[model samples]
Target: MPILLLGNKDIDLISGKRNITIRRLWKQPLYRGDRLFCYWNILSKEREKIFEAEVTKVKILPFKEIISNSELPHKLGYKNSKELEKDLKKSYPNNTKDNDEFQIFEFKKLHVTQWEGSAINQKNMIIKKADILFDMGEYEQSSLCYQAALEYDPDDANLLNRIGDNLSRLGQFGDAIKNYKKAIKLQPDNEYLYNNIALVYLNKGEPDNALKMSNEAFKINPKNTTILYWRGIIYEMLNDFEEALKYFDEVLELDDTDPDVWNERGTLLNMLGKSEEALISYDKSLELCLDDTKDSNTWASKGNTLLGLQRYDEAIECYDNALKIDDSNPIILNNKGVAYMELDDFQSAIECFTKVLVMYPNNPDAQVLQEVCLENL
Candidate 1:
C-alpha cells in the first residue's frame, strides 16, 4: 500500500490520528507535502464506468499503509514505491519542456518511521493554518509558517525554496533573490533554484544576468530545455538574432509543434528582411495554432508580411482577422486604417481612423490619417 500525501507534511500516514509515532521512513528522507495526482483506472461499482479522480486535499494522512489494514484492498495504482517516485519526478520536467506546463510544484516527503507523534500533531496544526493563508493568497503569512518550520530544521532546502517562491510571487524580487541564492548555496545542484534566480533577474530587466545564470544552469545540466528556451529569448531581446536562432532551432528540433516558437522565429526572420522565409515560419505557426493566442499572432504576422509585400487588400483581411480576436488593439486598428487608405477605400479608412481616435484621443497619427481620409473623400 502506497499513499501519497495530498497536502501539508505534518500529518501521519499509517493512522489519521495526529501525534502518532513515525518510524525510520520519516526520519531518513525529509518529506515535503505533495498534492496527490493518482493515475488510476478503477471501476466505480455504482457508476459502472472506469473513472478517474485527481483527488485534491488540504491535508492527507499516510495512505501507503492502507494495504496492511484488513478493511482495505491489496491493489494499488502504482506497482511499487520506486515506480511511484519515478512518475512523480516525470510529472515536473527538469527543464526540457517550456511554458507553464513544466512549472515546478512544491512537494515534500514524509517518513512514517521517524516522526514524533506529538511533534507531528503540532506540525499538522501549523500546516493547516498555513494552507488557509495560502488559499487566501496571503503568501507572506504562508511563508512565515514555512520559516517557523525551519527553526526546527534549518537545513530544509525545499521549504526554503517554497518560501523564496512565495516572496517572488508577492513582488519582493530582491528578497526572493536573496533566499534563492541561499538555497542555491545550500543545494548547489538544484536546477529549480538556479532557474528561479534567473527568473528574478529577468523580471528585474537584467536579461544579461539572467542569461548568464541560465547558461550556468544549462552547463550544469545540458538537458534542461527550459533554460535553453529562455536563453534564446534573452538573445532575441538583445538583438543577437543569429545566436537566438541557434537556440530556437534547438528548441524546434526537440518540439517543433510549439507555435509560439515558430512565431518568434518568424519575427526574427522578418527583422532580417527574409520575407519569404518569414512567411514560411508564419505558416508553420498557423498550422500548429490551437487557440486564439496562437491564431491571433499568426493573423498579425500575416498582416505585416502582406503589408511588406505591398498587398494592401490581403493585408487588410489579415488585420481584420487579428481585430476579430482583439478588437480594441490600437496597433491593429491603426494598421487596418493604413491598409484601407492604401487600397483607396477612403470611406473605410476614415471609419478605421475614427475608431482609433475614439480609443486614443491623443493619437496624432490617427488624427492625421483622419484628415487625409476626409480630404480624399
Candidate 2:
C-alpha cells in the first residue's frame, strides 16, 4: 500500500469525503485499483493510520484549468481559486506537460487508514506552533519559534528558509539576506530561495542586485512565470518600462488569464503615457478578474488614466465603482473629489474632499482641495 501522509487539516478527508488530493504520485507505482494507505498528521510524526482508500480514478490536468473550478478552491482549503493557482504555479511550475504551468493530481479520498496518534517530537511541535503563528500573521513571534526550533536541528535548510522569509516580511532586510545566504549555502540550487533574496533586494531599493539575483534564479528555472514576473518588476523599478512591458507581454502570452500580469502591463503603459492603451490593459485585467478580485484597485487605475485623458464623468463613474468596493478608503475618496472638481461640480467635489478630510485628519491636499471647491461654490 502506498502511504498517503496527511496534515492536521487532512483528518477531514478520511472520515467520509472524496476531495481530490494534490500530491506528486508520478513516482509511485500505482494503478486505478490500488489501495492507498493514509496517515494523519504525519509531518509531526503522528503516524496514525487514519483510513484506507481505493484509487478509483486518477487524472492529471493543467493547473490553469483546475484553478478555475469553484469547489476545488474550498476543497483544497484556499481562500480563492486565484490564490490557490498562484501558489501552485510558484511551487509546481514544472509539473505540467508544457513544463510551464502546474499539473494537478486529481484523486478521490475513500477511507481512513485506521491508526490514530503517536507523540510528536519536541522539534516538530515547535515547528507546528511556528507554522500556526505564521498563518496568524504574527511573523515576529513565528520567527522566534522557528529560531528556537533551529536549536534542535541547526543544519535544517527549510528552517533557515522559513526564518529568512519571516525576516524579509518583517523588513529586516540584512538579517533576511543572511538567512537566505545560509540556506543557499546548505541547499545551493533552491531557486525559490534565490527569488526570495531578490525580493528583499528590491525592497532595499537595489534593483540592479535584485535583477542579478532574479537572473541567477532564472538560470535555475528558466520557465518559472513567477521569476519572469519578478524580472518584469525589477525592470519597472529600474525605469526600464519598455523591457518591463515586454516581459509582462510574454507572461500574458503564456497565460492571458493572469490579472496580475495584465495589471503590471497596464501600469507600464500608463507610465509610458499611453493612456488609451493603458485603459485597454486595465480593462482586460478587470474582465479577467474573479469575484472580489480587488477590482477596486483596477477600477481606480482605469479612472486615473481616464482622468489624465480629461474624461471626468467616466473617471467619476470609475471612482464610484471603486468606492463601492471600499467606501471609506481616503485615497480613492480624494481622487474622486479631484474628478468631481475637474468636471466643475464644486458641490460634489467639496463633499468628496470633506469625506477624505474626515477620514484622514491630517490630509493637507484634501484640505486644500476642499478650500478650492468652497471658492468655486
Candidate 3:
C-alpha cells in the first residue's frame, strides 16, 4: 500500500481545506488513480490513519518553477514562495536545487467504506481531532470529542486518560478524577495514569491525596523524572521544603535541562532563605527557556529574587519583561510598583500601582501602595 505520512502542518488536508500536496518525486512515484493511505505521523511515533484518498491529478515541475509561481506555493500549503523554498531545502537538503523535479499530487478523500486498507478507525480519527483541540487549548471541545470517541472503544485506557486530561484543563476536577480512576482500573500498571491522578489532586489543593498517588507512581517507576518533579511539588505544598528540595535535586541530577524543575528549585531555595543560591537556579531556568513569553512566571520569580537582593533597577526590568507577556496579572504589577518604590521613584511606582488598582478595584495592597506613593510625592 502506498502511504502518505502527514505532519501537524498537514492537518487542514484532513478537514478538506487542502487537496494538493507538493513533494520531491518518490522512487515509485504516485500516478493518477493511485490509492493513497494517509496517516498522521504523531510526535509520539504513533501513526493514526486519518483518511484514504485517490490521486486525481499529478503535475511535474522544476523546483525553481514552483517557487516562481505565486499562487502555486499557497496551494501547496506554504505562505509564499520563500517559505516553500526554505522548507524544500530543509526537507531535501541534498536534492533541492533550482532544477530538481517535484511532483504535485492532487487527491480526493475516500469515504471510510471505500478505503482499501483496514477500514479507517473512527475512534483513532476522533482521538486525533481531540488531541489537536487539546493542544489548541479548546479543552471543552476536546473533552466532547474524546467522550464521543469513547463510544467506539469504551475500554480504551489511553482514551479515558486523555478525557481526564481535558477535564483537568477545564477545571472539572471531580469528573477528571473519575476518568483517571477509570483509566487506572483498565490499565493498572500504567504509571502515567497514577501521575495524572496526582496532578488532579494537586490542582484540587489536596496535597495529601496527591502524595498518595505520587507514591503509587513512584513504586511503579521511581526513576521517572515527571513523577519525581510532581513529588517535589507535592512535598512543597505540604511545607516539607527540605524533602521537596531533595526531590527537585534528584530530578535535576537525572535531567538538568528541564527549565521548570530549575524554576521550582529556585522557588524552594528562596523559601529556605538561600537567596543567592536561588538567583543561580532562576538564571539557569531562564537560560534553558527558549520562549520568554511562555516563561513569564520564571521572569516574575527572578524579579522577586532580585528585589530580595536589593537590585531595584534590575528587578524592575525583570518585572517589565514579565508584564509584556502577562499584563493582566495584578500581582506582577504590584510587585513592579514595589520595585519602583524601593528605588524611590514615587511617580513610576504610582503608575504601576494604579494599573493594578484598575484591574483589581478591591486590591488593598495596591490601594495602600498608591496612597503611599502619593504621600511620598
Candidate 4:
C-alpha cells in the first residue's frame, strides 16, 4: 500500500494501516534523543497505540513509488522482492549490486514517539524549513533564511556550509565562494567546505582555482565523493580527460546510479573518440532518465554518433528527437536537414532549413541550402 496525505494535516499510511497527524510527530534539533513515538488508530478502528521508532530509520514518502504501486494488487508480501531487485538493477544497469541488498522505495509512516527531551526549537525549525525550501528549489529564499540563522550561530559549520550551497544554486557563485571560505576559516579542519569552494570555482570556469581547492579538500578527505567530483570537473575543464575519467570512475564506484555522472563521462568519451564507450554511457543515461522527452544534447550526441557510423536514418531519428525538445535549435535543425538531404529527401530537408531560417533570417547556410533544395525540387 502507498501512503497519501489526507486533508491538510493528516497522513494515511495505507501500508501500515495507520493514520497520523503531522502535529503528533516529534520535531528534532531540540530533542534529546533520536527516537519518536506516534499515537495513532489502526484501520481496524478497534485499537489505539503509540509506536516508538528511531529518527534515522524514518523514511520520506516518494511520489514515484506511490504512483508505481497504485495499480498493483492490494495484498502485501515479500514474495516480489526478487522482481523489485531486478527493477533496481535495470534502473542502473551499469551499477553493481549485492545479491541480498534491499531498497525501500518510500518512507516510513509518521508517528509520535516518547522520550524526546524537547520539541523542535526555534533555531531547528528555521534550519529545517530552510532545508525544505532548498530541496524544493527555492534557493534564494533558502539562502536568505540560512544567512539569518548563521547570524545567531556564526560558529556553526553546517549552517555556514549550507548557506554557501544555497548561494551557489542561486548562481551567486562569488558570494558562495566567500561563504565557503568563511566556513573553512571558522572550521579549519572541514574538508567539505573546501570541496564546496572548489565546486563554485569550477562552476565559474576558474579551473585552476578549482584544482587548488579540490586538491586541498582531497588531501584532507581523500575518500570524500563530493571532493572527488569537484576534482573530476576541474580536470575535465583543463582537458585532462584521463584524469577526469579516473575521478569519475571512483565516484561511480561509490554510487553508480548517478545519471549525471554517467552522462558526463559519456560526453568526455565522445570527445576522446571512444565511440563504443560513449554509446554505452549514453545508453546508461537514457535508462536512468525518467522523462520520455529527449533533451537537446542527448539527441544531438546520439545523432552525431549514428552519423559517424553512417546510419543515416537512425541519425535523422535522433535529430528529430532533439528538434522535438527544442524546435528553435538551429544547429540540430540544420544538421538534421543535412541528414535528410543525404537520404535524397529534398523536400524534408527544405522544411528543416526553413525552420532554421525563421530563427535566423540572415543565416547564409540556410539560404544556400534552401536555394539548392528549391533547385532540386
Candidate 5:
C-alpha cells in the first residue's frame, strides 16, 4: 500500500538477510497485509524499483518503550536502538516530542516489477492504497482513494461501506447515509452498517430516528454490546436517563469489565442524583481503565460527584487526576476552581478560574467565578 524508498546498501542488505524495517513519523501510509513497491536509488532522487514486498507484520511502539531495547535495531544494521533513534530523529523530525510512536514492518520481498499495468494488479493497488490511508488517519484522502478504487469496480459493497465510514468521520452525514444505504441494500445483515446509520442520525440531531435504527440493529442481535451501547447513548442524549440505564445495565451484565459502559453508567447515575451509587460505578471505571489517561472524563465525572457531596479535598484530588491527563481542559479547571471556592480557598480558586479564562476567554462562568473569588479576597 505504501511505496517506500531504501538506499542501495540497506536495500541490498534487506534483500539478502534482513526482513524488518523500523518506521518513525511516516506520513505516507502503510499497513500489514499491504503490498508495497519498494524503490532503491544509490544516489539522488532518481529511483529504480528493486522489489515488491508484502507486509507480514506491523508492531507499533512508543520511543520510551523501544529506546532501551537494543536487539531489534541491531538486526537492521544499527549499533543499537539509541543510534537507530538518532538516525530516526533526523528522518522523522516531528517525532522528537515525548510519547511519539513508531512502527516496525516485517515484509518478505516478492518478485520485482519494473512496470505494473494489469487490471487486477491496478485494482489491488488502489484498495491497498485506500486501506493504508485509512490506517494513517487521513480519512478524507482515504475516502478519495476508495472512491477512485470504486471507479475501477463500482459494485463493491465493502468499498461503499468504507467510503461511508470516512464520510461519517468527516461529518458529511447525509452523503454518508446515502452510501451506507447502498451498502445495506447489498448486505442487509451487516449490523454495523445500521449502527453507522444510527450514529449519523444522532449527529444530525434526529435522535428519534437514531433510536429507531439502534433498536433495529439491537433486535437483529440483542446481544451485540456495541449496538446496545449506542442505544444507551441515544437515550442519554434524549434525557431519558432511566431508559438509558436499562441498556447500560444490560451491557455491563453482558461484560462487567467494560470501562466505557461503566463510565456511562456512572454518568447516568450522577445525572439521576444518586451520587453514592454513582461513586461505585466511577470507581469500577477507574479500576477497569488500564490506560487511565485515555479516560479523563471518568476522573472528571468522579470529581463532579465528589464536589456535589461537598467532599472538597477528595474532589480536588480527582480533578487533579483529570488535569494530569488533560491539563488544558477549561471545564475541568472551572470545576476544580468551584471545588476550591467551596472550601473558601479563594486565592487557589482564583488561579484555577484564571487558567480557565486564559483557555476560554469568553467563558461567563469562569469570569463570574474569578470576580467572586477576587471579592472574597
Candidate 6:
C-alpha cells in the first residue's frame, strides 16, 4: 500500500491541474502500476483521504536535471523553476544537492466506484486514520481503529505497540500491559517495548515491577537516555532517592537541556531536605522549560523549597506565579494558604483555603485549615 501525503495541493490534485508529484526517493519507491492512497495533510494535523489514484508513470531524475527542465515546473503547478526549487528546498532542506535524486510520480485519479483495494491496503488506511486520531488526542477512537487494524494483521508488533500507547493514554493499564507484553513477545529485542511495560506498571503504583521491566530495557540499551530517565523515575517512586539521584545525574550529563529531569532532581533534593541545592535545580528546570504547565509545576516546587527555608514572602511570590498559570490546582492553592498562614495573614490564608474548598468540597485538609485560620482571627 503506497500512501501519498499532499500539503496545500489538494485542490490542484482534485482539479486535475497537478498530475505529477515530485518527492525525495522513499525507502520503497512507487511503481507505475501502483495504487496510491492520496491524503491531504491539513495544517492542524488532520488527514483527509482525497481520492485513490493510479501511478501512471514514475521518473527518477537528478535534482539538477529536474530544475533545468523549465516546462516541468509549470506542469507541476508552479509558476516557474525558481518557485519549484524554493518549495523543494523548503520541503527537503538536507536533500537539495545537484546529485540528489527525486522521484516524479505521475498519477491519474480514479472514480469512487473504482476505489476498491486489497485487504492489506485497507489495514494501512485504518492505521493511517488511527495515527491521525492519536495525534488529535482521540485516544479511545484511535484504540478502536488500531483494534480493527489488528484483526487484519494480528502479528504486527508495531500495531500492538500503537494499541498499547492508546490504552495507556486512556488509563486502561491492564489492557495496555497486555498489548505491550504481546508486542514484547513478538519483538523481544526491542528495548522500547520493555520500557512501555515498565511505564504501565509504574502507573499502576507497582514500582518494583516497573524496576524489573526497566532493568530489562537498561540491559538491552544501557546508554539510552530514555531508559536512564525512566530508571530514575522508577527509583524515585520506590523511595530509593540516592539511586534516583544517581540516574538523574547520568541523564543530565548526557543531555542537560531536559527540563523534566531537572525538575525531578529538584523534587528529589527537596525531599532530602537540601533546600539550597533544590533551588538551583528548580531554577535550572524553569530556565529550560518552554511549556506553561511544566513551568507552573517548577514554580510551585521552587515555592515549596522557599517555604522550607522560612522565606514566606519569596515563597508566596513563587506561589502567585504558579497560580497565574494554573489557578485551579488545589495542591498549589493549599500550599499558598500555608505560606500566608506562616506570614500570620490568617484572612488571606482563609481565602486560599476557601478557593480550594470551593473546587473540592470534600477536601478535608482545606476544611480543617480554613477552620484553623478562623480560630487564629
TM-score of each: 0.61, 0.66, 0.65, 0.61, 0.67, 0.66
- Candidate 4 regions exceeding 4 Å error are 1-120, 132-138, 169-171, 186-189, 291-296, 323-328, 359-368
Q: Write the per-residue lDDT of candidate 2 for residues 298-320, one digit (tens) a residue.
A: 99999989989999999999989
Ranking by TM-score: 5, 6, 2, 3, 1, 4
Per-residue accuracy of model 1 over 1-377 as CA lDDT, tens digit each: 12323223322211122222221122223233422321111112211111112222222223333222342221223455455334434543352221221111222323424332212343444445555657778787677766755655677787678778888889899898888888888899977788788888878888888888887788787666677677778888778988888887888888888888888889888888888898888889888998996688788888988888889898898888888888887778878888888889989988888888888998988899889889988
Worst 10 residues of 1 by lDDT: 46-55
Q: After superposition, how far is residue 163 of candidate 2 from its true place, in Å?
A: 0.7
Quality of model 2 by C-alpha lDDT: 0.78
Give the per-residue lDDT of model 5 (tens digit) for 230-254.
Answer: 9999999999999999999999888
Q: Residues 20-68, candidate 4: write the lDDT tens digits.
A: 2111121222122244443333233422222333433323333235224
Question: Candidate 2, which segments miss by more than 4 Å at Cα?
Answer: 1-118, 290-293
State the C-alpha lDDT per candidate.
0.65, 0.78, 0.88, 0.66, 0.82, 0.88
Task: Give candidates' CA RMSD values in order.
Answer: 16.5, 17.9, 11.8, 17.3, 14.1, 15.2
Q: Which 10 residues in a row give candidate 2 its minimum summed lDDT?
A: 111-120
Which regions of candidate 5 are displaced past 4 Å?
A: 1-121, 151-153, 291-293
Error of 1 at 139 (Å): 5.4
lDDT for residue 102 in candidate 1, whole number 0-100: 17
Off by over 4 Å in 6: 1-121, 151-154, 171-174, 358-362
Find the candidate with the highest TM-score and give its number. Answer: 5
- What would you estimate as the lDDT of candidate 3? 0.88
